[model samples]
Target: MKIIAGLGNPGKEYEHTRHNMGFDVIDELARRWHVTLWKEDMKAEIGQTLVNGEKVLLVKPLTYMNNSGEAVGAIARYYKVDLDDIYIICDDLDLPPGKTRIRKKGASGGHNGIKSLIAHLGSENFNRFRIGVGHPQDGHTVVEHVLSRPYGEDIQKIEDAKIHTADSIESALKDGVDHAMNVFNPKRKG
Candidate 1:
């Protein structure tokens, strides 16, 4: 069994915000997999499906962004899923907008959602799919930037990123994390 969790705040107002990239990707995956029903459990909206003969749970935490760990940790424990079988999707303010990076294990990079997950899960060994939203600019505060929806070309960029992220997740499921990382993660210029 594999648990794929997307972190974001829960509310109609939070939809399409930069910080809700994770939820957007989850929706994309749900669409691709034909998952139409979501049950509320473990403080999350869960859609269960079979991907390549693997039982996959697509999760959108309902605990909001900062307290996401509480729901994710409870689900992981109840499901008895190994840390390696858990995957996290979230926004990254470091990379350029629409870019993505995958990490096997690491620090949260100051992301509150990731920090909460680490605190609740008692480890940072899970896989992460980070969709870049970029940092604030033009005197915009981080909170304001993350909460606001994208505009103009950025709208297309983020839409493309969501598809790219869903493809990457499929690759990780079909192949292995190492292989998926090689295929999806951009080659860094030394």
Candidate 2:
């Protein structure tokens, strides 16, 4: 994979939201790569770095979560990157907080960012790393919960997941998606 797009909305208001888990992972990756991802082109924040000596583009879409495809598709086209060489990191509500999953390719499972990606890019073949943020609680709507900040213990869990997500991305770069999946995909608690 030559491109890694972390899914999230732009703006400080969305920084700590559960929906921004993808951005958190991207920030962690940027720190690891020693690159700040400050570039303001392609409708996203982009930076170039090497993972395991493999050149990779790290992207944080500024198109907001629902329209993330605009930035990602633009980057892919600009770089002439193959669709198969793109990967995404995103939040997943189906799993428990802190858990993560990796997939070679799949449906969006109702993730608007991913759905937009499939529509814009015309493919679901790109790899994805899903960070589990858990569903809303306390009668909060899904939108309310995802946009709200996590509290207490959930904070640490999400933070840990970011580190692990970076590690998983590195593994995918060095090895392959299957290897990353085996190494990083957490077992469910059910």
Candidate 3:
């Protein structure tokens, strides 16, 4: 089974925050697939479904961002899922808003959630679907920017990225990462 974990802090306070983009994308995916409800697990809010005929466990870790690995590891271990079959969706500040990137394997790039997962799992080789949230303007703290919400045009970009992120995950799960990368990495004009 494939475990798709969307990393973010749980609770209403963190909802709609920039750092919670991962959760946003997964919600979009579940909506598109018509998955009606998310069942609670020990460490995650999960939904079970088939994506392109493959069994998929959609997980939103309730362990918050820094400790996300605990929940992800538990689910993955119980399901006997390999690192390659795991996909993490999270926000990226390096890329401009509305952008999405898929990588088969990579370092955490300093994302706390990804770092914790790597630490617990003891591997950096896993699929990642990164949605761009963009960096703050000059003189702003990174933490403050990521925890804050977007506005105006930025909001539109984030919404678009969320939809595209879901599409990329579906593509990667169905057709493989190479095909998904080719189809999604390039700039697409609206």
Candidate 4:
């Protein structure tokens, strides 16, 4: 079994924010698989399905973005899932909007949600699927930038990226992280 955890803050207020990109991806997955993520467990909303013929657990942390690790860690422990069988999706400020990057494992790159995962799990040996939201323009505060909804062209780009990234995630679960990275990461642009 594999666990796919998408990190984001709870509440409708953050539904379309850049910080909620992860939640959007999770929603996309649930829709694509024709499953409902209304089940709550371990502080997360979950849906179950088969990905590449393997049982897959789709999770959206309900503990907010910063404390996402708590929910994911609990699920992982309860499922007795191996670190290698875990995948995480989140927004990345380092890359421009629309870019999607997949890594087998690495540092948090200054994302509090990712940092929390690294801390609670005590390991970075997992998958990270990052959707770019770009850095704040000029003097804009990081918080404000992430919480603000995208406008005009950026909105379309983010929407496209989300769909592509969701597909890439399915590919990763079907093949392997390396294959998904080779197929999608090379096409990423900042």
Candidate 5:
């Protein structure tokens, strides 16, 4: 079985913030798979279904962003899922807006949520699908930018990123990370 954990804060207040991009992607995946995220175990809202004949557990941790690992580790332990079988989707500020990157494994790069997961899992060897939210203009704090909502063209870019995140996740589950990376990492023209 594979576990996909989308990291973000819970509650309506965090619904559309840049920090919640992970939740947005998982929500979209649930919608596409016709699955209901009603199960309330593992400290998360979870949906179970078969994607490409593979048993998949889609999770949105309710422990919020910083403590995301608690929920994810719980689910992983319960399901006997290995680190390689787990995928984390979260927002990245280093890449330009609307861009996405899929990495087989890596450090958290100072992301609190990913850091928390690493602490709980005791390793940095997990797949990650990072959706770029872009950095703020000069003199803006990253905390402020990530907690804020996107506007205008930025909003459309965020939406597109979410869609692509879901597609890449599906590809990863169906065809492996290398295939997903090859198909998704390059720039695409409209």
Candidate 6:
């Protein structure tokens, strides 16, 4: 079984905020796949489905952002899923809005959620699908920037990124992670 977990704080106030980018992408995928029924399991909301004959679990952790691993670890253990089959979606403050990136393995890059995942999983070998939320600008703290919703053009940019993230995950499911990375990852100008 494949586990696709999206990191976010669970609450109406957190909806569509920059910090909830992971949840936004999962919600997009769920909508596209018609996964309307979500059940609580392992401290998370789970939507089950099949993609290319592979059983997939769409998970939304309810342990908030900082402690997401508690839920993810439990689900992974319960299902006996391999680390290679786990995909984590989360927001990235390093990249500008409207961009996304896929990494097979990496450190958390200061993301509390990913940090928790690494702590619980006992490895940094799972897949990551990151949506850029941009860095905190002006006098705004990182917390304020992430907890708030985007405005004006940034709002549209984030919405587009969410759709792109979902498409990339679908591609990863159908083709392979390498193929998805090649297609979705932006080229760096060196």
lDDT tens per residue, model 4, 58-126? 999999999989999999999899989999999999988998899889988999999899988889888
lDDT assessment of candidate 1: 0.93
Supply candidate 2's per-residue lDDT for 121. Answer: 86
lDDT, candidate 3, 67-185, per-residue tens: 99999988888888999899999999888887889888888898899999998788999888998888887677998888888887999989988888898888888888888999999
Q: Identify the runs in model 1 with alpha carbons over 4 angstroms from their true place.
A: none
**Model 1 lDDT per residue over 9-112, tens place:** 99999999999999999999999999999999999999999999999999999999999999999999999999999999999999888999899999989999
> Which is the better candidate, 5 or 6, if ranked by lDDT?
6
> Model 5 reaches what TM-score against the true structure?
0.94
Instruction: List per-prediction Cα lDDT, in the order shown.
Output: 0.93, 0.88, 0.88, 0.90, 0.90, 0.93
Candidate 5's C-alpha runs over 4 A off are: 187-190
Better of 3 and 5 by lDDT: 5
Give model 5's clash tally: 0
Enumerate residue pairs that collide in model 5: none
Two-way lDDT contest, 3 vs 6, winner: 6
Please give, for residues 6-89, the per-residue lDDT of candidate 5 as tens digits.
Answer: 988898888889999999998898899999747998789989999888899989999989999999999999889999999999
Cα deviation of 124, candidate 2, in Å:
0.9
lDDT of 2 by residue, 7-110 (tens): 99999899978999888888888888899647899799988887777789989999999999999998888888887689899999997898888887889899
lDDT of 5 at 109: 88
Error of 1 at 8 (Å): 0.8
